[model samples]
Target: MRAIQITEFGGPEVLTLADLPEPVAGPGQVLVDVTRAGVNYADTHQAENTYLAASKLPMVPGGEIAGTAGGRRVVGLTADGGGYAEKALALEGALYDIPDGVDDMTALGLIVQGATAWVMLRKSVHLEPGETVVVHAAAGGVGTLAVQLAKAFGAGRVIATASSPEKREFALSLGADVAVDPATPELRKALIEANGGRRVDVVLEMTGGTVTDQSLAALAPFGRLAFYGMASREQPSPISAPSLLRHSTAVVGMWLPHVLTLPGDIMRRAMTELFDLAAAGTLKVVNGGEYALTDARSAHEALRSRKTIGKLVLDPSR
Candidate 1:
């Protein structure tokens, strides 16, 4: 099997391509012949040694892939970091049957970002109908899905925030009613105006740092903010307990790997709904450029540059 292995923690140049023995499925695991793999920000973080969990050396850095096993075409997550290869191992529970008519690239979208967006709104936050919802980084992978899911789940208003004009427009095309550029200093005022002078009911916050406190200040009464990632790599502003009590607002933290520890029912349901929407052609999975497995370094560079849009995929066969 061929894979991209990071022998040391450093930049994209460290993601070297190499040949390795195919991994066998263990007692509770299944071997998958990978077709398309998804490249994520977490992969860059892991390679740079700044992720929440440090990655082991000489490791493959992908966590999810769309592939086949046992004559069944499936898309799923690997138990360890091995999705960047022609084959990988996944727990049976992690594998999902790909719906009919969904291609590998589209199915790949449902792995990390897709699942996270679905779980956040459909499970964690439980966004209500007729309530205003705000999505941060609304043009990225998770953000694109989050914006669409917010509208599909019946939020009365969806406000999408992005750093640039193009991203904001892309979010609007994804069903966000209002799109705001947060690059300006007056984030609070911009967010408020986007929401028609009303506080937001549900906020999908992925970036960390000062944006955390700003998103909190933009919350409505009895609102909920789900903090999922710190893409900015900066320390998020702490939430004051007194402020929460005074405003009747709540803060929720989400780490996708941690969520995988619980029962799979909710995630299963979310996948079903998301796939159904995609199959119906009602939801479009925003996918970026496709890169060859050997070009993993360039892919990581595009991601860190903050210029790439949607989910970037890697084709090992390419």
Candidate 2:
């Protein structure tokens, strides 16, 4: 089996293609013939050993796989991160049967990015109908889905923030009511204005640092901000109990991996609904680009460059 291996912690340059022995599934796991592997921004952090969880060296970096197992088409997370290969190990309980109407790329999108978007809104924040929501990085994988899902969940207004005019337009095509530039001189006021001069009810924030700070400032009383990822790799000013209490705002953190550990079928339910929505043409899956398995480094470069939009995947068969 050919796989992209990382022997040292660094940047995308560390990813190298190598022919390795096929991975064998142990108890409670199955071997998936990798067809498509989802590439996430977190994978870039995983490559550099800077993610939420420490990553062991000499390992494969992909987490999501959409392929066949036991003669059944499935999509799932590679718990130990080996989905960049021709074959990888996947937990049986974590696998979801891909719907007939959903293609491999769309199914792959639902695994991590889609699930994260869903759980952040439906579970972490408990978004209410008619609530005004702001989605950051609106053209990216999770942001794109979050924008559409926020509307599907009956949000009164969806304000999307992107870095470029084109990306903002793309977000608008996905049902975002307003698209503002996160890099604007006055992001906090921009967001509030986009919401018709009102502090938003909910904010799906990922880019940390100043964007997170401004998003926090634009929160309404009793509003919730779902802080998921720190794409900027910069720390935001620490929030104090006094400040939160004074503003009557809530800041909730979400990591999909941790959310998956909870007792219920959150991931599965989210995946199922996301797949169904994509299958029914109610949701859109934007493809940034697909890279060959050996071109994993290029995928990482593109994702980190912040020049690409939507979900990126690797075709193992290539």
Candidate 3:
């Protein structure tokens, strides 16, 4: 089997394609013939040796995949690495069957981002009907899905923040009631005005640093802010617990890996619900682009540059 390996932690140039022996499934694991691999910010973080701890000299970096497991099409997260290869291994519990009519790229796109958004909206914050939400990075992988899920779950208005005009337009097309440039210093004011001079009920914050402070100011009394990803790459600001107490607001952290470890029935039910929404056309996965396995380095560069919108995938068979 051929896989993209990072022999050293550095830039995209360090990712190289290499031939490796095929992997055998352990007692509780399943060997999957990977058709598509999801490219995420976490992959770039691992490439730079900043997020996950450094491994041996060489390591595969992909984390999620959509493929066939024991003749059944499925989507799942991988515990270890090696998803960048044509074949990979996944724990039996991590795999979920893909719904009919969903392609490999779309299914792969949904596994990580869809699950993240679904859990955050339906479980983490427990968003209520007619409540307003502000979603940061609204055109990115998780953001796109978050916007749609917020609307489908009965959020009265969805305010999205993006870095570029194209991204803002994309978010609006994805059902965001208002889309604003995240670069603006007065983003909080813009959000309030967009929501008819009212603060939002919930804020889905993916970018940290200054944006975190701004999100706090944009929340309504008793609103909940769910912090998921820190794509801004800036130092985290000190949070004021007293200020939160004064406004009766809350800050919640979300990580999908922890939620997936719940009882088997819960995990299965959540995944099944997301797939049903997709199959019903109430949810959509925007495929930013697909690249051949050998082009893994280019995919990393695209993600780091923030030039890609929605989810990107690597086709191992290509």
Best by lDDT: 2
Residues 1-318, candidate 2, lDDT per residue (tens digit)? 899999999999999999999987899888999999999999999999999999998999888899998789999988699989999998777899998978888887878888888998898889999999999999999998899899888999999989899999999999999999898989999999998889999999889999998999988999899999999999999999988987799999999878667888778888879988888788888888999987889999999999899999999888
Residue 29 CA error for candidate 3 (Å)? 0.9
- On a 0 to 1 TM-score scale, where does candidate 2 land against the true structure? 0.98
TM-score of each: 0.97, 0.98, 0.96
Summarize candidate 3's per-residue lDDT along 162-236 as a digit string, tens digits: 899989999999999989887788878888898999988899887888888888888898999998878767855
Q: 237-304 in candidate 1: lDDT tens per residue?
A: 66678999978999988878776678756667767888998898766788788999989889999988
> Which candidate do you rate higher for lDDT, 2 or 3?
2
CA lDDT, every model vs. true structure: 0.86, 0.90, 0.86
Candidate ranking (TM-score, best to worst)? 2, 1, 3
Off by over 4 Å in 2: none
Model number with the top TM-score:
2
